[model samples]
Target chain A: MTDEKDFLSGYDPGDFPAFAVTADVVLLTMRAGRLCVLLIERGGPPFKGMWAFPGGFVKLDENLDQAASRELQEETGISGIDLTQFASYGDPDRDPRMRVVTVSYLAVVPDLPSPQASTDAAKARFWPVDDVEGTLAFDHDRILGDALSHLRTVVEYSPLAASFCEREFTVADLRRVYESIWGVDLDPSNFQRKVLGIDDFLVPTDRQSSSSAGGGRPARLYRLGKVSELRPPILPPD
Target chain B: MTDEKDFLSGYDPGDFPAFAVTADVVLLTMRAGRLCVLLIERGGPPFKGMWAFPGGFVKLDENLDQAASRELQEETGISGIDLTQFASYGDPDRDPRMRVVTVSYLAVVPDLPSPQASTDAAKARFWPVDDVEGTLAFDHDRILGDALSHLRTVVEYSPLAASFCEREFTVADLRRVYESIWGVDLDPSNFQRKVLGIDDFLVPTDRQSSSSAGGGRPARLYRLGKVSELRPPILPPD
Candidate 1:
């Protein structure tokens, strides 16, 4: 054992346990009115042929955020979307090979093009979140559950639900983002009233969305508001 | 580079990242009407003599939770308290010694005895949360801030604030937990009403706390109720 004099100078890093750190991104979006997540199939061993959240090991030179971005672009062909560092999973047996800890990231994207798989992925595509089964390659089933719960909780107080909508959208569009994610039918009038009651929750735009066919009235468009926080946050029903 | 045939056969885990994983526990407890966090002074580099959250490297045989428990006991000698995994920090430049990613855990312990520094620490003690300047080594200050914010938010809905108190405590005790953490004053009557209004928040105990001196009154003692969720969460004052 080294004394204070030999502590820093003769310290051997190998004396401590070695662990690999990876990043997993849970990219959620709405397609055909159903919530979906981006997933990839591994081209190589360990969990080859099984579906997993798009991810890879972090590089020595890169930060966790940069690694998440690079992996997102490599696996899903999506970039510039806001990614939040959600949580970390470090269960020793999570990885079959050895000790591996993964930092999980979450993002809600608008309508996106089909994803293309590269690097270690055999294929990449958007799969409906409701259709997800326990066959996920790792602890991803648990990770996805955590991400969904966070989404449910935060969407109430934040403009997070709007991230799944177009730049200029209607109250109906925003409501659908909540309805689809929570998998519950929100009373249209009450949700509209509650959202409007929240100060600066949304800003009314001059233009209105075109109403199709039967000639109902075109709904007014609203943009994301400047208010950062919801004081009395809108919460999901008990 | 190995071909598909040789990929599985020749895969070397060391070919990728070689990061050392660590568990940092942010143990918070109220001492003398103030919120305090347990910290340790390092005896060796890379940041010797500076204060840091009680933490150390994960051992090969121990899981992350076990590492956190061991590190906490080694640094502060406080055990049997529940520690929750909150987040992970993996910024490349976080640790100057080597590539290390740490999972941060949040623990709320009741009034504890003075801590004894063991293992790698020179000294261990609880420092008031408000007194913590950015003088913390590594990104511990940021991690501490995140834990405090999470605490302030969750204590309203979750039974988190109670974790800082002994069993069968006064409403004043619970209110002090909020006041200390949020650093705000709660109107006594309104606070009591709101807390009691939350169904099953507390169950009255037959015992009453002894009145300190004069004739104010002995506060009622209550135990935690079975209700798991707080429907309408209590919000901090604006």
Candidate 2:
């Protein structure tokens, strides 16, 4: 074994079959009070013409996070968003042609205009998360499920829920993000007390949105606070 | 861009460099009231002669979980244990020799004898997790930290805490598992009530431990119950 290890130290790339590693971005944003995911229409085979997460093969010089961000920029003309590497999918059959291991990332951004398709995709669009009724290309269906579970679990303990909102948002706006993702309606009074009571979860801002939705008293706006940790985390439904 | 996608589809494996993917096991067990991790002394180069997590290169046909479990069984001669895939580490430089991505898993088992070394490892032994004081080989230090955090968090909301015990265990025994992992002292009265009050968390075994450690009354033995989900999970210390 010692000799084998020593011999392998100088192992060359030609020794084993090369595998392509890529990063797929599940860029999520809130649109019309519903959670939306950014997806692309493939322009080439194997799964050409099918909807998939925006991504591409990783460059040899970049790390996983960098690759994910780069893919987002290259494929969607989107940039400067904070992307988190969530998990890696490596089922042998996940890819058809050869072995491809995809490191999936979750990117949260403020609501924005439709993305301009670039690179290998024919079209880029944000699909309401609730509307993912059709089968996704590749093993993306499972990847999306894992991302949603991670988001649901982390939202309770981390201040990540605010990432989907604009710089200034009302308490109702923030509540909708949680309700939309968890697929449950929360008691408005309890939800309000919980968010505001958490001393550092939100920072009050002296801003207000124009009375747009309907005739009601203008609501105060708040921005995401600097704190990253949430105390006594708000657990999701069982 | 469409043409570029077409070019990529025709791209051969020979075009890109091949990289190896591996799985490492953070196999954990409770022994003599202390949390212990399975470690193997490397018999190969790179970090030859140092202790590290039990792992190996993944087989082409096996899934990530299968590879991890196979590695555990090969290294420790243990099988049929429940192992959970937690995270994947893929820093290009994580392994100095090549670009290696390692999927890590965490497993809990009842107390077992010192593992016999097998396969690539020269020696297999269980070390008290607290005693792993220095840096480990191949980015294992970071992997260990992530696994421990997952364990601490999962124990609260899942029935996994009892995986460290035999089919029947006393309340004191279960409390010891919590203390070993959290490194905290808990009030026996409160802990007992909390565990018992959570319906389906545990069930009476119609049995009793041969003796009690604190001395006074005989301790009742119980087995894990059917409930898979935990409500109002036991939160760790602030």
Q: Whole-model Cα lDDT per candidate?
A: 0.80, 0.78
Q: Mind giving the per-residue lDDT tens digits that candidate 2 earns over A44-161?
A: 6778877789777776667778878777777777888888877888888887787877788898887885455333444678888767735678888888888998899889878898
How does each model score on TM-score? 0.91, 0.91
Model 2 Cα shift for residue A83 (angstroms): 2.5
Write the residue-wise lDDT of candidate 2 on B150-213 in tens digits. 8998888888999999889989889989998899988889999889988899899777888755
TM-score of chain A of each: 0.88, 0.90
List model 1 lDDT by residue over B125-202, tens digit each: 789988886778888989988998888877877887888888888888889888998889998888888888888888
Q: Candidate 2: where is the Cα deviation over 4 Å?
A: A1-14, A114-122, B1-10, B114-122
Location of the lowest summed lDDT over 10 successive residues in candidate 1 chain A: A1-10
- Candidate 1 wrongly placed segments (more than 4 Å): A1-10, A113-122, A212-215, B1-11, B113-122, B213-215
In model 2 chain B, the worst 10-residue window by lDDT is B1-10
How does model 2 score by TM-score? 0.91
Q: Per-residue lDDT for A58 in model 1?
A: 87
